[model samples]
Target chain A: MRSVTAENITETFIGYFGKDTDPRVKEIMASLAHHLHGFIKDTKLTHDEWRESLELLKWTGEITTPERNEFVLLSDVLGVSSLVDMINSNPAATSSSVLGPFHVTDAPPMALGADFKRHYEGEVILVEGYIKDTDGNVIPGASVDIWQTAPNGLYSSQDDEQDINSFHGVFTADENGYYSFTTIRPVSYTVPSDGPVGKILDATGRHPWRPSHLHYIVSAEGYRSLVTEVFPNDDPYLDQDTVFGVREDLVISYKPQAAGTFPKEGFELSGKVDSAFSKIDFDAILIKK
Target chain B: MRSVTAENITETFIGYFGKDTDPRVKEIMASLAHHLHGFIKDTKLTHDEWRESLELLKWTGEITTPERNEFVLLSDVLGVSSLVDMINSNPAATSSSVLGPFHVTDAPPMALGADFKRHYEGEVILVEGYIKDTDGNVIPGASVDIWQTAPNGLYSSQDDEQDINSFHGVFTADENGYYSFTTIRPVSYTVPSDGPVGKILDATGRHPWRPSHLHYIVSAEGYRSLVTEVFPNDDPYLDQDTVFGVREDLVISYKPQAAGTFPKEGFELSGKVDSAFSKIDFDAILIKK
Candidate 1:
């Protein structure tokens, strides 16, 4: 028996991976153990700290539900989700962001330029974006799935009174890859602060607010679909989003248009618009698979 | 906003720690983030892998209970616990090993050399050890808390039929730092193999068997408390203990003694002569705090 010591324990652990193990799994496991052991050794972690970490994880799991995956949120607050997003980013395409727990794959289909502001009280705003391939050609019939929080800064999934698709919709782009919808403008909101993720943020003296933004998953035939979000340049939390999900290229400007200047063609709010509103225009870019 | 790229995201994450954050916490969190992010980036972890990891943690949490701390077991199987043991080990004293999750503070007090063999059936063995200071002076009245699995390869905590103190006791050293007890010999056992930890070990083609051993938490009034374990040298799993907890210094041989040669003084089994039994003598060393 080669005496097991702190110095050789890492290698000894990796050595347990046998010939029958998958090469990739072995590689990942070895590296994970390497860094994990390194962190423990470097910190000289105390028994109290180690047990506390386990408690944190237990708390995270205990609070997790189908509606709120605390684990995903934990990964988000730790910047792990963003790091993974960045790892898989394509230089020629739009950068990806966190797929927060609120996304429901069954978002109802939306009509182009339609508004869904009847169920909530908030400032109505126009959000339009084009879906294009890496070569800059508009991808007709591309689908854009979008969802945002209500005026109260809670998603439909989070608000018991709201329908599953309250602010979520799947809209098809036109021949020019143009899609538009009017809804309550998304507001900067704090993440769930009553959970373990919140405890970590509190410990670090970090705020829990995410920047004002719209979640999007845009896809078309024969392209690597883009999973991203568009952040208004003026949002206070843009640079310091709680989940670190923002990218420079994904930041956009929201133009405050006078009531009379609101687009009259194909817009649901054309006839009812008697007040000023903001407009955000972004182009969703995808790489061909 | 300093645009966060794959390379700068780690720095941005650390920058979130404010002045009010504990300096040690910041250091640990920063190092954790550094290594965690590095692992993700270096491996180019896929979205599938990222989600799988969250699931793994969730499963681990789901299986944890007051009696079964799966997280601690997870740490043990990964060799983190052993590393911590070595980190805090004193060179002048006996080497420490993992304080496996089975220890409980309420072990019943035991006579110095009494046997607890009536509760179970297996090969009877004598485990005698001395507790001394670093200067090699025996420390009388040093309390030694001990526990071990039964012949069925289960600890009292793991076996429902066994009482809480079935194979557990707290024995005090004599004026010369000598302590001894007789009990059913422990058998090598596999850790819980139906949980996420098992899945990890299985994926790596690693066995889950730990070497047969006894757990100890020894302390003297004026010395540092030591939590360690001892293994028989002849055990097949000694070198590759599933938890990597074996230290050469803590391994001893269990010498077979004929019933006629068993010690009679201060021993419960002295009158009930048996056929054959094993005897192991070890001396535990401690460092004064």
Candidate 2:
């Protein structure tokens, strides 16, 4: 038999991708094909090299698990994951942050100013926040689900049987879009480094620490819901956050108030306790519904 | 625990990758870390969106096989595979081309000018080339291995029970760096698209067709070996090669000559049996020892 040119062969191979059946799928596949073809041409690849790549990928699949997603980590490490996020996220609303590896469904709901800190406390603090539209109107009855790492930089899920929801909480905003909770200060923490992501970090000379911040998913009727995080002003890693999640608009000052007197008028504590507490305030701006 | 400012957190993560051991692993890992962090930061990715990505990748892994390398195909579609190949291939010799899914090791070695048209025969062709230095000196005893698809664009290996190594052969160049073999013209063919690679192609509109070309792996003492293809000059899809392997230098015109006529004086072939034989002349330049 005779040998065929790579061009006709590739055309015949790619013919299997259906046309216009799904617009989104078509767009993505076309772009992917274009880039892939470009890459092949640019590099002048070989058959053995191609086969070796196939083997590596096959191994990647063999090693993946429900709890350990190597492929997602591959995409994440490749920047494709973030590129998708950038294209889909709303820039006007608070900047979105990485939905980390630990978002489990179903957390117990709590009332306003309630201490969801079931265990482990480093300081006594009163927290409050208002959910509002960009027009500055109150969004009453809004649900503000919050969570963060503990003072020791660990989450209950990160440690087996560590009952301290430590910094995890869910709060409802009042009629004025106001809510508050008490907890100890959270320190910046490292993400799991034992997997592929860790292997990658070690190879690239990068840090694994995510900056100290609070995760929030806020929702209310007649306003767009938001998923975001807020960074404190005093944390030294503010400017160089590892996950690149820090935003100037999202950073709030954590002020140190006296141990005994009412922390401050607009702040939420009524004749504060004997321990010093840090105060930070942030207003949530929703997009028009 | 209370959350700290983003700045301190950022620095900590950055330092982690920089201090890791194993330079090679460290380099790749840190690059992944830095870029991934950059992507998350640039996109401000949301947790739910990240979860969705993880699930998509998980599915990518679950459906791969030895016969069907979805991951390699994924890399191929993404251009990473080709890019890596280009970075590693010998740059000064014949241009390296993608090794499609059909090569099996241990092709039967045949004498010079031996015919490979046993199972399917429609035409008689003579493939002749020289193994030489860039300075035009012949390299004696160079090995040239050739393989291609059947007249119908099917490889013998993929045809099962057709006998292994049916259309593949290895030939030794004579003292003058001249090597000749007999084989038919290769027909353009389509690649397999029934797997994940196919699904991806379906999601994206693409055609896979390879133009007619001859695959060759040439090697000799004191020279870098080369794996490349000589494409047909008249292939209709040269410009649209799927694997991006079209190079002007690799395209050759085949001349049909009378079987028994001695067209050239210095060359011997005064009374060879032939109906119509196509002849090609090209030199393989070896890099310095």
Candidate 3:
């Protein structure tokens, strides 16, 4: 018999467990062992290499805070995050996207057609959309929560000292399933490159820019909620979204229409610009309950 | 066009990354976004749930030390370790067994018939084996590195922390591809279950115990090397190695032979018992170089 050594410690450890146990746990554990052993055997992995991987993971945990989730980023970069999502997300709803590292709670509720441009300057685009079921029935009283980036490419929350919700709002659709919000066109920008995910990108020689877009989560009784993004038709990064989240139907045309021809006159910005820079009619298709 | 707000901070962050980027980065990032978004969207996974997972990983790192590897243990119990092993262990050599997690470099080399039980006591069984090509030709100078648990069912390295190399040795084959080592019979025992792996085991309600066995790594200049474990014939745990590392061919039998049966002066057990307890012939098969 061979004396145990550090190299076989993993096996030595597993050699202790009894066979009578939950099959799921056993199967998963076995699968994990196969992959991990494969990695070591394939690489004939050295001790130092193992140590480095462990150390890197340590750094991954050390840098994560309540606000900054480096593990999520790590999982994201590893593709496990998405794999887990595929296993759980609603198959009928619009395909779910990555839950990024920055969502905080407690958004104030507001009404339709309300101005969400709390304190940012950009083209005041009227975002008019309908929340309808797949069968084309309007989902009246649907709630649509929306958010976007500043023209300077930063979120209000990114600045701890700022009171401005530069690009955030919560809006409820009217009885006719009509929803609209007044806000500025968002700008395309790069993700923060100071985290481990960023370091990995740097090491791998990759960029981190995302195209201009607006975020929306529309929900109502008796209808499937839709969490989606609408992108500008002409944004250069539209074709190169770092996260591969672009869908053709999800891209809205930014038409420069006449400002005075707009509906629902609040009596402001009579001639905001020589011509309306863009007016996009963005609607969502929610599944019937 | 909604303004960014505190409530949707996470979504805004995800949106910022999911919009656009290089094609290479896009595919990976999009998949990540989709999955992460899927986790939150599907589990309705609370922020605290996400934080808890991160904390679990953080503790996994904190508990790891220079002498112990928790992540590998995690990977092992998860089965990634064996998956990796299965993928990489070549089909050509005598099937490679789990390396386990305790191999250390710098083993002291010895000649044929040398003893490995310098600081332990048990039935002095003589283990002799042949190293040959698949064609049965003797391969001289092949090294047989061996180790086993002490009589108390613990590995010397695990129990005798102060005694370096207590039950580990390397023996070289003579001109006839024959090698021998004197040692006590390894006893079945439980593996360490005092860490996170243990907690997982307890949560799942599983016992831990490995059958009596001997570990061997055989290597010759012109033959493929092999790493394997030989289970004691009929050991209860043979069918339930917690690590799932048992292979039928690797099991050996112990026959009660007559005293002085060798009838050869070259191989003799000193301080032999009047009544022989157990004796066995163990051999290994190797592939061509």
Candidate 4:
């Protein structure tokens, strides 16, 4: 029998899949096998360690549900999601960010200047942004899908206290490429830490807080769709987002606005606040497909 | 907020766990983050690819159960288990091999020259081996744990048709440092190929056959335990073990013995007189702790 040593194992494995008809699959498997073997070799991984790693993976898998994907969370916390986003992102287009695990399809479509916070109770904020192309031309009829956690730091999907679709909406840019919505200012909150990924954070002493941000997936005809997030500059976790979703171009200041100074065209002030209202203006840029 | 690019994401992630109280966890997390990010960057992975990868991980995890561990099998098929074994193995001791997923604790102990195949229906074979130290001195009372698939190529644990503990036993070497057991000649078999690992193999056109071999875990007082396998030199799959568990020194020739030529000390001639028996002689060497 041929002796299979570490020195020859890699070649043997790669050879097994060398004849794969699918080039992409072949490429992926080869690279995966190579790096995986290299990591084990570099770490001089012990049998006990190997067992622990396998158990970790098993636990991670066991906790994954359609509503809560622990594997995606693992990829996020490991910064792999961000790396992949950066790699595939078009530099000339709006910078991309991590598409966190909370995005849901078929979000309720709302008219421009509508309120997404139907039952939310927090500091009200008005967000206005324009959808433009790299050439500075307005992209009319662009779709902007937005979602964020409630003030209590739990997403509408995760917290039963909030109404269905609270703090979530899909709006379209008008002729002027302008879209506006009224909602509560998002609060920085910890990522779900009750599962295996959370256990990893706790064991490593890594904080699980993600910066307060709004998730958006912007798209229009003939333009590349951009899935990203906009972060407030003042959040403590701005630089320490557990998922590393922050981008310089994606951060904007939430300027304080006097109660009467709120835009009358798209927003209605509901409360007399001393310092509880803010306004943020940002723009989304997309590249031609 | 700082723009999180591919280049900066790694540093940001490593910094999160830099203050980890456990240095080993810190080291492992940092290395894991680095390589994981490196792999993403090297592959220039696309968003679709990332999603597919995440989905693949989810499926791999979801399919895992107590009876079947897809992650460990993944490690095995990818040659990661073999590589880790090589890294941790003592070169001076008996060559180590993959501790396949079938080993179970609390195996029934038997006297020397016991028959492990209580209900087996195949060519009878006698396996005799000595337990020795690196210095070649006999290590009396050494424990030799052995397990293998039955003639139908299914391990006792996997095949319901076989009785519990069939083709499985733990024996002790005698004062002469010798151990013997009677079993049916092991037939080459395929690893379980109905899971995610098997799917990958099928997609890649790689066979899942492992060489016919007997699994052994040998240990004695004052010596480090050795976990390995012995393969019949003539097996066609010896060079193609799916898990890459074969080692040169672990392969032995099984001499065909006439019915009456078999050792009478522990075995009984129950079959015809032609060529219904085989004898294999091997030895196990352990390193001093």
Candidate 5:
């Protein structure tokens, strides 16, 4: 038996898994053990501190459910999720961002120019975008799945007042690779701060707000999928998004339009809008796998 | 708003807690964020991998109960607990070791030279020890808490077949700083490997055995407490204790005695013993706070 010591424990742990058949698993476990032990040594953590950390972790797990994933939130707020996202991003493709915990798998499909502003009381906005390949050529019939929080700053999954797919839709690009939708203007909102992650934010005196953004996962049959979000260039929290999900290229200006102006072809306003509408003319570029 | 990016997320997280009133919390949080992001970057973790990690963490939390702490076990298996223990050890005092998750607050108190072998059926052993200050002066009236697994390799807390305090006892040092006890010889045992930690061990092809050892927490008024364990020098698993709880100075040899030989002045055997008994003489040195 090897007499285990603090100085040798890291090597011992890594050695124990040295025979892992999967190279990826071995690499990940080794790095994890190294960093984990390094952190403890750097901090000289005490029993009380260790106990508190365990308790915090337990609470983070306890607060997580199918609809709410506190661990992802924890990873996000700690910058881990964003770091991973950045690490795995393909330079040849659109920049990737944190795939937050709120994505719904079965978003309602809609026509290219359909409006998702059912019973919404906020300013209506037209979001038009093109799906193109890196060669600047259009990829027609690409799937554009998008979701955002309601004006009240709550995701449809988080609020019972909204329909299951409120402010969310899946649209297929037309033959010209164009897709458009009308929905409530995105507003800056705070990430869920009512759980263990929230406790950390409050303790650190950090704001939990994420800038107004629209999530998108665009895919075409022959191209690599892009999972990213578009941030409003003027949102106050753009610099300090709680989940660090913003990317420079993903930030775009939301052009202001007069209340009665129609930006897209064959589009009509369904509600009596008296306020100016925001129009975002964003385009996505996908890489061929 | 500053567009968040992978390059700046770590600094952003650290800055969020820069104004923490408590310097320790700030330091710990900053270091945690740094190492966490570093690990993610090193691994280039994928979205699927991130989701798997979250699920594993959730299962780890779900399996934890008041009696069983999977998080602590996670720490122990990863060498984190032992690292923390070594970091906090006082050089002048007895070396500290991992406080395995089996300690109980309500251990039964016993007089000096009492037997803890209630209904135990294994080779008998005599454990005698002294508690002293760094100056070699005897420290009387010190509380010595000890616990160990039964010969069957199961702690009283982990096994329902044994009574709550079987193989566990608390004793007060005599006027001469002497303490003695009788119990069955401890056998090497495996750490619990039925949860998330077990999954890792299995995947890594690592055995979960911890060498035969006796847990002890000795403390006196006006003196710093010592939380440690004594390992049998000859135990086959001494070098590879699963929790890395072993210290060089804590390992001692157990001398063989004829079945009828009595080693101490006030020692008495409570049950019939036709087999040889092992005797260990060990001493503990504590530091004054």
Candidate 6:
């Protein structure tokens, strides 16, 4: 386009989109161009900044792989992921949180109320949750996928030293709309910062620490699926999650319980030589599809 | 940052900057965060869109190399490069244009009036120019670097079949502040469209063609360097350059000349050319440093 000035470049850029383009694509591209141009104009972004920013993106892409998505981490640190969660969130349902780059699709299935088949040593906590509709009625047979970091604060995918499926398990809600799992408490961990995203965080003196939490992806027939996490209310990082994924309702207490607290019947944990442990009772709420 | 809703996440993200952060970096980062959040909220961007955008970036990075910079193409097509040039431009000086990714660091120096050593054949054009200050006084001993696409409309850097220094030359204005070059006239060409940027243009139904022009970087001892291009006014793509790099003031005409009209004195083409040629007369003006 001729004579494209800073003031007119936004619309001009969007105008390049042909009339045959998808309306939704046009809208998204237009808004992105508008806001991007606005940012540049507002900052009068210097040549050095522009060049360096592009370089940062280039390096971020270079560091990305199938198992490690630095782009998602970039979005998470910038709070775009959480902002998207918040904007697209359904208030009538359990709040969705940022899904960090650690979740994989190959977690082995587990029986309800059973511990994942792991022999790691740590404070074992039983996370018990029920699936319910907006009307407070139970959704029996709801599907639940759960994952968490090891006690050392590393997800299995991030630490090759750990099993690929460590702390990962899946189950279906019982006829009573309940699901449970026994696993080591997830510890607060830093987002992998050995790459470009880490440089950005370091440049601004920001920390990459995320609060300890258990990841969950819950769904059922006739209801919307919910991807979320439960944070221990006591986590020091709760107030400053690097990804801004924390929701007050999603924070719960790991209450100390007696040795017999973990269910024995219909549960593999079943008092099998267990000591004192904590239990987190949470209910996942969903809205109708 | 607690309570990070879409409305407040912008400020929260910015507030993460530590007190010790560089003020300039803080301003740039804060403005970027604000605009990015605004775009997300404005678009109410969907999950699929967010995910797809990240994937697009990952692919763009995967394709980048030392010779090929897809990010520059990304920025150029979106008009950020041109807008930056426009805003950073000194109105009294020769207008600046996108440097583009084709420029190499090592162009061999040519004499005051000479042709590059390329053996390619096409419409030979005599390009002559004087370097001057904003007040219109010629600046003796000014440096000028020139380059352009081959007759086939592909730059040496883009087409491996061509010499690495094809059509590239460096020059120093003589005591008279005049310099000239005899090279094949550049033709309209499409930017490399075999990457993610091409995919974007394809999705938007936007063409990738750029107008024919000669690239120049001119500088004097006491004047600001000027990075610009002189476009042929008659070029069909002059009004539709994909990069929005055309400046009305930078457009020039190529006038026909007799077979022997090409300069012979202090020029390499001196009577060596047996065919009629066109000539372009343009001047580059620079502001005080």
Local accuracy of candidate 6 as per-residue lDDT tens digits, B146-183 = 98988788888878888888878889999878998788
DockQ of each: 0.77, 0.18, 0.10, 0.75, 0.70, 0.71
lDDT, each prediction: 0.86, 0.62, 0.62, 0.84, 0.83, 0.85
lDDT score of residue A108 within candidate 2: 68
First chain of candidate 5, TM-score: 0.94
Between candidates 1 and 3, the lDDT winner = 1
**TM-score for every candidate vs. truth?**
0.97, 0.72, 0.66, 0.96, 0.96, 0.96
Score candidate 4 by lDDT.
0.84
Candidate 6 lDDT over residue span A39-76, tens digit each: 88888987888899999988988888888889899999
Model 2 spans > 4 angstroms off: A1-64, A70-92, A121-125, A150-158, A162-170, A256-279, B1-93, B105-124, B150-169, B195-200, B254-283
- lDDT, residue A166, candidate 6: 81
Residue range B1-289, candidate 3, lDDT tens digits: 3222223323533455433455544444444344344444444443344456556676666666665666776655554444444443444444455556555446788656666676566766667778777777878888888877767776655675535466677888888888886667788877567876666767556556667777788888767677777777768777656555565556778766666554335643455543454665767778775
TM-score, candidate 1, chain B alone: 0.96
Per-residue alpha-carbon lDDT of candidate 4 for residues A57-154, written as tens digits (9 for 90 to 100): 99999988888999999999999888888888777677889888788788899998887777667878889989999989999999999999988898
Winner of 1 and 4 under DockQ: 1
Query: For model 3, what fraction of the real interface contacts is kept?
Result: 0.12
Runs of candidate 5 with Cα error greater than 4 angstroms are A18-21, A271-275, B18-20, B263-265, B270-275
Which candidate has the top score in TM-score?
1
lDDT: worst 10-residue window of model 3 chain A: A1-10
| Comparing 3 and 5 on lDDT, the stronger one | 5
- Candidate 1 segments whose C-alpha is farther than 4 A from its true place: A272-275, B271-276
True contacts kept of 4: 0.84
Q: Which window of 10 residues has the lowest lDDT sum in candidate 1 chain B? A: B268-277
Candidate 3 chain B has its poorest 10 consecutive residues by lDDT at B1-10
Worst 10 residues of 2 chain A by lDDT: A1-10
Tens digit per residue, CA lDDT, model 2, A177-245? 998876666788876666655655555665666668778888887766676778777777665554555
**CAPRI rating of model 2:** incorrect
